[model samples]
Target: MIVAFSVTPLGVGEEVGEYVADAVRVVRASGLANRTDAMFTTLEGEWDEVMDVVKRAVEAVEARSPRVSFILKADIRPGVTDGITSKVETVERHLAEG
Candidate 1:
């Protein structure tokens, strides 16, 4: 599964980058196949591991602020892996063929 999520602390004004970084750090430390883009951090793993990471990441941000906002999107295609990179690569390949 590929889970792309964005976590942010609410009521914290404009300075949420540090809190977001904390969440990203948790994801990185998990050593799962992951990617961090401007909007979302994508984690590739089984359902349990992926949800665990997301929960912990939310906790990291929640620690700083009383309220938090989180958004998640998941692609659960069984018998497949590396969708984080490979899915984008496949699209780019199709574009190149044009």
Candidate 2:
């Protein structure tokens, strides 16, 4: 199974694009593919791991800019899109297959 999320950030000034880019990189680094509009699809070992990754992703940004004034969130859920879910699921299958 896989958990996916929609990541949204607000009030980003100056380097808004850069900030967004960094966040995207973080998710991709986690082997998650971001769909569109801040949504990411990734695999987790379990439910807890999925949430933990989401938490870390949020913290990564918060830790960077305290004065962020930038509001952010990740909307995580399972089984939203058939393909996305399958895509994330592939990660788990591959891990086991390896």
Candidate 3:
């Protein structure tokens, strides 16, 4: 499955890069198949492991701020792996063919 999520620390002013980085750090340290774009960090793994990483990431931000806003979207296909890169690669392949 592939899960894309974002963590925003609220009531902490306009610049929240540091807090966002805290969450991203947790995701990176997990060693999961992942990519962080401008808006979301996408992770590919089994259900438990992926959710655990997301939970830890939110906690990382929660530690710094009283309120945290987390948004998550998941493609929970049972028999899929490496969708993090493969999904994008598939789209690129199609575009190239055209």
Candidate 4:
């Protein structure tokens, strides 16, 4: 299964990329998944593996900063997952169905 998830803020800024990097590092270190890049990443594993990545990402950006007000959205999917971009597509499909 592929699950795509992301950690984003209210506004776009330099921190946006930082948060992604921080979270990706945690995921790679967890030994549950691999880190592809700072902004984009791909972790191959089961549901637990994917969830672990998302949890780490949440911890990485649970602060109230000037740019990062809060988590704008968090989406997960199956089959194959990337980062924010693919996750957004998953979201769009759900919205369209609704």
Ordered from best to worst TM-score, the candidate numbers read: 1, 3, 4, 2
List pairs with backbone clashes in candidate 4: 2-79, 2-80
Candidate 2 structure quality by residue, lDDT tens digits, 1-98: 35455444455556555555655566667654344354443444345655666666666666655443333333445555444556559999999998
Against the true structure, candidate 4 reaches a TM-score of: 0.49
Tens digits of lDDT, candidate 4, 1-98: 44435556545555466666676677678765454544445555567766766676667765533344322222344565444355568899999999
Look at candidate 1 and tell me the lDDT of residue 91.
97
Two-way TM-score contest, 1 vs 4, winner: 1
lDDT of model 2 at position 69: 34
TM-score, predicted candidate 3 vs. hidden true structure: 0.96
Q: Candidate 1 lDDT, tens digit per residue, 11-94?
A: 989888999999999999999999898999999999999999999999999998989989999999998988899999999999
Query: Each candidate: what lDDT?
Result: 0.94, 0.53, 0.94, 0.57
RMSD, each candidate, Å? 0.6, 8.7, 0.7, 8.2
Off by over 4 Å in 1: none
lDDT tens digits by residue: candidate 3, 8-61? 999999999999999999999999989999999999899999999999999999
**Which residue pairs clash within candidate 3?**
none
